[model samples]
Structures are given as structure tokens and as C-alpha cells.
Target: PVHDDDDDDDDALITDAITGKRYRALRHEEAESLSDHLLSLWMRAGPGRGAELPVDSYKESVLEAVRASQVVVMVVITGCGKTTRIPRFLLEGQVRRVRRAECNILVTQPRRISAVSVAHRVAQEMGPALRHCVGYQVRLESRPPERSGGALLFLTVGVLLRKLQSNPGLQGISHVIVDEVHERDVNTDLLLALLLSSIKNNPDLRVLLMSATGDTQRLSQYFGGCPVVHVPGFMHPVQARFLEEVLTEMGRPTPPRRDREEEKEVAPDLDLVADVIDHIHSNREPGKDAFRADRRGRAGRCQPGHSYHLFPRKQLDRMAVFPVPEILRTPLESVIIQAKIHCPHSKAVDFLAQVLDSPDSQVVRVAVKSLMDIGVLDAAENLTPLGERVACMSCDPRLGKALVLSALFSCVLPVLSVAACLTRDPFYNSMQNRALVSKAKAALSGSSCSDHLVFSRVVQSWKELQGRESKQEFLDQYTLSGASLRFIHGLMQQFGENLCEAGLLDASAECLRLSSGLNQHSQQEQLVKAVLIAGLYPHLIQVKRGTVTKGGRYRPENLSYRTESGPVLLHRSSANRGNPDLSSRWLTFFSAVKSNGQVFIRDSSVVHPLALLLLTDCDLSERGNARPNHSVLLPGHSLIRWEFSPHVWELLWDLRTSLQAMIHRSLRRCDRRSTSGGCKDSELVALLVELLNNTDPEPGSDQEEFSTENIRSDRL
Candidate 1:
């Protein structure tokens, strides 16, 4: 008999014997089983008090397939009970065949919303008595199963990957069901590869792949000829009307024909949709018209509904049968990092090649080069200590680096806010009143000349507000989304917890509070900006000064900036979009996008030259005999050069060396989970912060002595 006490304490740190790394252990309580009467009630009620789902009919087949094979594929249709019922089937089967405390089933969803909603629906169906056994986990939030076994856990793919980082074998899990494999997301694809490897070693483990629309045969072949189970959908008949049919029904003549060029543009015709809606509204009886809108291919299967297809049937048929997997379409840096962490011995390229759809070799090489350039991987493509810490985080590798550096610099609070904002912007821009939203953002930004800082300020101000009415008023005034702010807050807390798990921060609540305090120091803002530079290095933009007017005012339109990719305008939504009189010539931007044949930078910040000198990746060797100019060039960015006096350059070099050493030392301490040797270099961080504070020139100050110069590569 397995007791609940077999699970470790919530606060307990379990050390891995192989890597000698420590991580927080999960605590599970003994789950109370549902009463016989409650179970009878659930059976009588059925799913949502309806007839049995199509998936319910195939429950025995699914269970039998799982028992027969280590890998099973279920190609169920949408609206079937595959997402919720299949996991319950596996869990109950395991409970009856084995010890209830040893039956652990993990079902992976592609999105948090689905994972959470399905978990709630399943819990509701299971009755309140056994509700604790059904739970879900997503980034920054989770209601994990109460018991260690007889548990049906629903979690996002990314959450499961994070869990696998610590427990690669998934020691206690009996069945792993991956839902929505048709999504073909990077995480899902990667999860499939990892599970394929895991199943070979753990004969006791069963892997089930569920999808509504995917290449079933290909997935089965990838899983070594796995048994496939087909479950019909339970959706009512749907009436789908195409654009021409809708227009004919409405007795509206077609508009003028478009040119071939115009016909190639595949954007949705919103006007036609509105016309259809208006016709439906006018023709239908009062209160009889019901409409539902869903995106992608799931719209028609969302129940007994009428789906209006805006595009021609031929265009729909021309669309690819399956989406190009994210592994092939998206950047592979994060995937490569995770692959390295999962299989330390296997090469990243080799491991990724085993995926269902391997990325291009050139793309993989490029990702490896980026990781090496960022110091996350060595020349031999092995995970550096920094890489290990980065792998522990559930964020972008660059943002993870920023979080670790912020902790070392004692500026975790602001950096976390900035990272969260970058992950998901909290500011709301009303399409009706764009100017008002922009004005509100500019007012909040003040003279900081930073869109990133604007987010931090908004979050801080929202938190400081006293009452619900006050908070709502504050949000309304700033045009901020309260839900997005709450999400950012949750992400900040999650990041803090990740830092603790990485051993870079103390796990104590008091230490966490202090570390995440806003008023850490007088120069907290400068430190935060410097850390941003450290994280977003190579994303630097060289600012070109605009011509001054006769009144000594700078022309905003004349102001331009250039990144390595080429010239880019400030995004209209940025706080510094029209501000030309920036304090720093160098700007660090969060992201850039091309629109209308023009590139625009967003979420930019002005940083001191000293901060860039100390933080960014600079190659002294690139200077070589060019030292007479007392200038250094960033690797792969020869278009920009930083010129300082000989003495200043030497001073900056010494500071950079010391900072690097401190970071390495702190990482080592963190890896060892050392109590005596803390994860911060107090004196060094203080000196760096003070230098940044003092060196940051005020707006309109003539500080061109240490300024950066933009030179054409040909000139260099």
C-alpha cells in the first residue's frame, strides 16, 4: 500500500544523483475516492446530461490497445470525448488492474485554455468527492492532482517538458497521452521525440497520441507501427454555407470582379461577413437566430451550427492538408537548447533529426550558431553552465538569461516585469481612440524614453492602487487591460519561482519579497536598463540624430535608427516613437517586424554607452591594430563602432572582465546550491550599478565623447 506520506514535502529539495542538482519536489495528498452513490449519479447524468459520446463507445478499444502496445494512436474527430474521456479511461483501467496509488496518467494539451477547461469539465463529471484527482497545470499557474496516483493530470506541452527536465524518465507516470498532436507545434513535436526514446527504455510506460486532424499513418510509422484507434465525432449535423451561396440566399448581386492580383490576396472579406450577418438578422424571427464563431477548421464541428465560409471552396481545397510543423517554420534555438538538456550525450542536430518532421540542416546550424554566440553553448555544442540555468527557466532563452543576470545584479523586480511585458503586452490600445491610448502611454513613460519601462511603471502603479474601483479607474485612464496586468503579475511570480528553483535566488518568502521589491536602490531603473542590454544584446539599434531646427528643437521625422538587419522606424505605439532627443545614442529594442516593406522597432530603451560596453558582446580582437582609434566593434555588427579614450576603454574592459568572472562564480555557486557562497557579488554589482548611474547622461546633455558611431561596413 502506498501512503500519501510517500510523497515528499512541498518545500523539500530533491537532489538528482546523476547531476547533483537540486529541485523542489512536488507534494501530493491522499485523494478521497468518490462514493458509490456519487459514481452512480455520474453514470446516470452522463457527460453534461447528454447521450454517450462517440469516444465513450470506443473506451474499451482504447484501453485494450494501451494494454497490448507500448504506443497507441487515436485519430478521433473533433467534439469526441478523446480529450477528456480517454484519460479517464486509462486512469480507471490502471486503478483496477494495479494499485490505485500507482496509476498516474498525464494528458498533454496544446494550449492552457483547453487544458484548464477540459480539466474542470472532467473534474465536474467525476463528482466533487473525487474532484481533487483531476487537475491541470500551465505556465505560472496549476491545480495539480491531489494524489500521486489514480490521477488524471492535464497540462500544457511546455509544462510537461519542464517537468521532464528534472525527471527525464517520468518515474511514477504509468500512461502519457498527448492530445492535439495535429497542432504540430514545436513543443508537441519535441515531446513526441522524447517519448519515443523514453518508451524504448521503459517497457512499463504506455504512450497514446490523440488528434482530430493529423497525418495518422505518418505518426504511427514514427511510433514504430503503433496500433491506431478511430473514434467518430459526436457533433450534430452542421450546415456550411459558402460566400456565393450566402449571397444568392440573401438575393444580393456579386460585386465587380477583381484582378488576378487582388484575387490572390487571401484575407477575409469582413464586409461580406457583415452583410451575411445583417441578412440573417433581418430574415430570422426575433430571438431565433443564434450564431457562433470559431477560427480555423473547427468552426463547422462546434455543434449543430451554420458555418459561413468567406472564401471559395477551391481555395479551401488548395490549402495544405496539414500545417507545416513549427519545427520547420520557426526558429530552432529554444528547441535545440531543450534537446541538448534532454539528451546530454546526443548531438542537438541528431536528436532533432529524430523528430517526426526534422528541420532543415541549415536552420539547425544557424540555431546552434546563435546559441554559441550567446554563450549558451560552447564551440563543441555542449551546454554551458549558463545553458543549464537557462534550460531550467520556462521562458525564452534570452529572457531567461536576463532573469538570471537580474538576480545577480539585484534588479530582479523590474527585469521580471519587463520580461513579462515582452512576453505579452499588457497595454490595451482601443481601435476607436488610438491617439488617447498613445497619449496615456507617453504620459506614463514620462522622460524615461523607454517603452519597456512604461510597462513596469503601469504594473507598479496598478499594484499600488488601493481599491477595486481605483484599480479599474487607473486601468481605464491608462487604457490598460486588467486581465493582462494580472497575467504579467502571475508571470513575474512564476519567474521568481523559477529563479529560486535554479538556485539563483533564496526560496524563502522574505528573500523573494526583498528580491522582487521595486525600491531596491536609488539607481534601480538604471540597473534594470543595463540588464536589459545584457539580455537583448545584438538587438541593439544605432540611433541617428535628426537635424535641429532654428529653435534648437530636434526633428522627429528626421530621426532614424538602424539594426544589423537594416534601417527601421520606431513603431507608432512605442513611447519613444516621436521622441528624437534621447539621452543615449544606442537603443536596445525587444523586437522588430516588417510592415508595408518597412521595418519597425518596438519596446525600445535608451541605455548608457557604459552599460553597453560592459554588458554587450564585444570583441576586443576585432579592434586589432585599430586600437589607435580607441574603438571596439561588436562581433557580426561592424556597421557600429564604440570609440572611447584609451583610459576609458581600459577601465571598461576591466569592469567587463570582473563582471564576467562574478557571473561565472555565481553560476557555479548556484549549481552547487551553496549556502555559504551566495549567488551574488555584492561589491561588484554595487560598483557596476554606481558606474551605470553616474555614466548615464541626462537628456539633451552633450555626452558625445563616449558615444557610438555608425559607420558603413565599406568605411570600416
Candidate 2:
């Protein structure tokens, strides 16, 4: 944010909270954050930055390697410009040099914005030779006169999957760049598996996987030895160090399971975040390092009575550093600073305020200056704007998972509560939050019903107020930290701006809704969670709902005995603990045991016994049974076995097939395609209602009341 005084409007440059670097503010009309500046360099980089290849060095080597083989998957590092340079290599003639080049170069990104951004950058570099040469295609957005000629297309991984699903041949695509493969996104993984199946026949397609160094190795092997290529980075070689045992350390940037998909197990990046943290910590002299002391008083609440930004009421003139606002910030992403305000407060707080206010932390202070050197406790003991964002995002520790989910379903709100579930988590050794995690989990189960994407749009809508002044005023009504309130506000603004820059103006509208308060927050995440299940189908852990808890807390009670059915909460992050706000629900047993024979007091929707039998559990093809028995046969990998009677088996199979087809269709239709102003979402509603209502195996015994015995049968 700009630091200015009415006394000297021209002195707008902000003082650094560390390393006394002074930057004179420029009165530019546009607003750009540090990330924007850095990323701008990437987007606008020219062949000027590229070193003249040693005639046959890196770029040529990559081309030669991929061209010789029918299928090539190569690993490259960040900053090496794989995303930027790979296309150049092909366009250089040797690859795409002459002859009627009919093949279209295709690239896929995790987020739609990344796809457009990369494509725009590449097209800019191609210049006049390719006015409309490079094009990008997203779910609802496309830019290309026609899909003819040799063109490079950038699209989201999910979008790519959808395209391939409809037309396996992919109608024109020669080279593919799956940038950031180390991320292991569900779409990317699935694309890999699916693409692998096509590799044997698609003689024209060549795949190149670009990943970060120090981490891409494993992903390389997973693909069975795609010739791995490494590019040395331009980052000033900072020291690299490792810490085998530090009581605790930062976890992965986003929860890998946010895609709502599951694998046999999680792949830890001890060599990434931890290693980087360790490298930083170990390099500094014990007594000379800096420390950060930032905390959030509480999160924002919706109230018509107060301003959400907490401004004009109890002015910052009375507070210090606003107790560091809670926002989710990663090292990457664009952030714009408007005005930086300093608060006045307690002695320690004041000291931190002063230190953070300093141009840099290289100097020392007597009372509080000494503490400024290390980040743990800022001289003023307050969080800098940057620190506050980091803290809020890190509040859940499992922010990675939450962020990952944001990318997929775009539901950061429920995950916001997931932060609560993360606080005071039961150690991985202990299952304290398991119950709630189970509940948070139910939000995403069942493929039979729909409303899957609604929750996503809901959270994205709720995120709108993050930076808006109205919201901060609302927070002031409570004793909430202004910084925390503003942090999220800023975070939302950042995401919104990114969506715009990514050219995700259309598809991102659903995600950008996180910044507009378009969708009212729904208590039910099932609508969104179900999509996660669809994406991560078959990788579930079912819980029975009728069992009672003994209350030791660490142990999980009886889980759904679904012959098949899980958001693999990040392996060991605080998500393992229940974020009270995020993970509040639990799975109950199936016995239908009444809390007092009341039977219908507090209840959760349970799946149909027959539905589970048809879709998840059944093997023996029995012939006479009319009802789906409580003991359903289960198939491994969640595929149901059909051991029931012909009547039961046929009925179950038909019901399941119908539900599956409808769900898959619903998944393909974007919320934007519907015109019913929310009413349009009824397709999923219709499917869910039908699935829920048709749970009875015996038409005569159609009971709406749910029995725990049929735990997996009830629909969302």
C-alpha cells in the first residue's frame, strides 16, 4: 500500500518493513502488486532474455527429444520458461517450421486464468507473424476466428478433459504442455492416465510435462520415465538447507485433496515448503534472525448493523497494526497496495508498529528495535500487510487443501470454516476432529444427486465483501481484528483481480463470485461437495450414521458400512483437526436406533440401502428378494457388486445407471448455462429429489423416513 502524508503528497513510496530498501512511489494510473510486477516480466518477456542457445543446447535438445519419440513427457523447472519457450521451440520451423502445419498445439493449466495468461503471453511474443495465431479456449470463453490452421490452444486441465471426453481424438492438437505437473491436480492426474491410454495410437500428439525442480522427480517416474529435463532457475542462488527435525514447520501451500479426489496416499513435499522454511531458518544466525508475531482476534460476521471494514467507527488512530488482519496469501499471486495505515497501541504493539514502519529491519532499536531483526516479533509486534495475509491463509494450516478446493469447486467459504476445524486439531495420531471431518466430508459425498456446483458459487459469492469497505465496518461492530477483516478482504480482491488478468472474466465469474456476494451462503455444502465427489469418484470412505459415540474423541465411531465410499483431508495438516467453523458435522450409524425411540429428532440424510447395493455394494445375483437387504455386497474400488435377487439387482442397476448418467450430464452444464436465476439449478434438484425419494426397494413400503440401516441410500 502507498504510504503518504498530507504534508507531502508527493512522498508516496512505502517504507520497507525489512531491509532498508526505499522505493519512490510512481503516480501511475494502474494498480499493480509486487506479484503483478514480477509476473508482468514473465508475460512480457521476449526472446531478448533467452541466452543464445549453444546452437544445440536446451531448447533444441527438448525439441529433438520430443520429436523423435511418438510420446514424450519431459520435466522442467520453474523460471526456465518451459511454458513460454516450449511453444517457441515448435514455431521455430525445425518443429513447426514449414509444411502444411495442420496440427494445433494444445496446453492445459490447472486454473482457467493460467491458461489464458500463458496463451496471451505466447501470442504476444509471436508478434505480427501470429496476430491471431495463438488462441485460448476455456469453458465459457474462447478467442480464435476458427479452430483451423496450426494454432496453439491454452485451456484448463478440466476443460481439456471435457473436450477429450466428447471427442477422444481432440480434433487438432500436436504438442501438449502440462505445466506445473508437480501439483498433482485430479484433472492433471486423470488426464495423464487417460492420455496414457491414447498414447499408443495418437502418433501426432506429443506430451511435455513441466514441473519445478527439487520436486518434479517423483512425478517424472510416475509417468514411467518421460525424459526428464531440468532448467536452472534465474533466482539469485540463495542457500538451500534442510532441517530433519523442527518441532513443526509450514505445510504444503494448498491442500492437495481440495480437488476432492483421493489416491492410495498423499505425496508429502518435505522437500518443498519444509525444506524451504528449513533452508531459511537454518541459514540465519540463531540470535540474529527475525520472527513474526501476528494473530487474528476473530473472523468477520454478517450484520446489517455495522460496517464490515470497521472503518470510521473505532478508527485505526486508536489501534496498532490492526492486530494483523486475517487473509489468505501465498508468496505468489498479485496484490495491490492502496494506502498503508499505521496504528497506535500498547507499548509492545507500539514498538512493533515503529519497527514495521521502518524503511527496513536491518537496524536495531533499544526497547523493541532488537526484536525487529527476526520476523517472529516485528519491532512493533504487529503484522505487516503482507504478514497479515499470510497469517489468515495459514490460519487453517490446511489452507493448501482449502485453496486446492477453491481451484476445483471454487468454494473457499466452507473451507473458511474448515479453518475453525483446523484450530486445536486432534493430532494425526489422535482422531479428535475425525467426527467433524466426517461431517465436513459428507458435504461432498454421493454421485446420485446434484447441486454439486451451487455451493462453490455460494462461497465465491460470500468472499466478495473481503475488501469492500462495508464489510470492515461490519466487523468493527464486533471486537474483530481490523487487519484480519481486511486481510480476507484484500485476499478476495486479489483473487478477483487475478481472475480478470487470467482472462477468466467469463468462467471465472463463478469463482470471481467469491468477490461479489452474488450467491447467498448455503449451510448445505452437499450441492458443491457432490461435485468434488464426482471429480474424485470412487475414492471415498463411507460412514455409518446410527452408532453412538463413547466420547474418547480420538476414535472414529462406526463409519458408513457402504460397500463403497472420502475429501482425503490433507494427510497431517491441522485439517486432521476439525475446523469448528469448517468441519462441524459427523457421520452417524445406520441402525436407526432412536435417541429415545423418537427416531426422527436431529437427523442427517442417509443413502438408500438399495442404492448402495446397486451402485456400491452387491455381488451375488439372488433372484427372489424384493427389498435391498441391509447386508449389501461391496466391490473393491467402490464399484458395487450385484449378488442380490434378479428383481433387486435389475432395479438397483437401472436406478444407479439413471443417476450416474444424469449426474455426469449435470456436471458438464455450467451454472451460467441455466437461465432460471437459481431456479435453473433445479436439474440437480430434480435428480437429487428423485434419487432421495426413490430409495425404497418395495414400492408398497415407500417410507420417506430414513433408517440408518440404509445409510448410503439417502440423497443430499
Q: Which candidate comes out best when scored by TM-score?
A: 1
Worst ten in a row by lDDT for model 1: 707-716
Q: Which residue pairs collide, candidate 1?
A: none
Q: Would you list the C-alpha lDDT of every candidate in the order shown?
A: 0.73, 0.39
**How far in Å is the alpha carbon of 218 misplaced in model 1?**
0.5
- Per-residue lDDT of candidate 2, residues 1-716 (tens digit): 22335534432233311111222332333223332442343346333323432222487677777777655556553445677677667644322343223335667787878888887787766664454656777644667523233456777876566455333544245667777765554346556655664565566767777765334555555556556665554322222112222222334233222221222123344345445545446764553222310101111111111111212222334544322211111111101100011121334332222221221222212323322221213444554322232222322212322232233233444433233222322112224444443443334323312112222322233345566576555333322344443344444444433333322224434443435332232233442343233222233333322344466444333322232222222222221222222211222121122232233211122233333332221233333345554223443433332334334445546665655444334323343243122443344444443543544422222222223334243343
Over the stretch 1-716, how does candidate 1's per-residue lDDT look in tens digits?
13333457532333221122343322344322422333443356443413467788888888898899999888888877677788888766665553455567888999999999999998888776667778888887778776454678888998888777666666567788899899899999999999887787667788999888889999999998988888877565666776677778888775555655665664565566677778767875554334543332454454555567776555566668788888888878889988988898888878988999998887899889888877789889998888878877778888888877877676677777888898887877645567887899889888788888888788777877899999999988888899999998888888877787778766524223533432254137777888888887777887776656779988755776788888788888888887867877778887777765788887799887777777765565435354555657766675556666555566667778988887777777744246223434566677776676655343443333454223112211
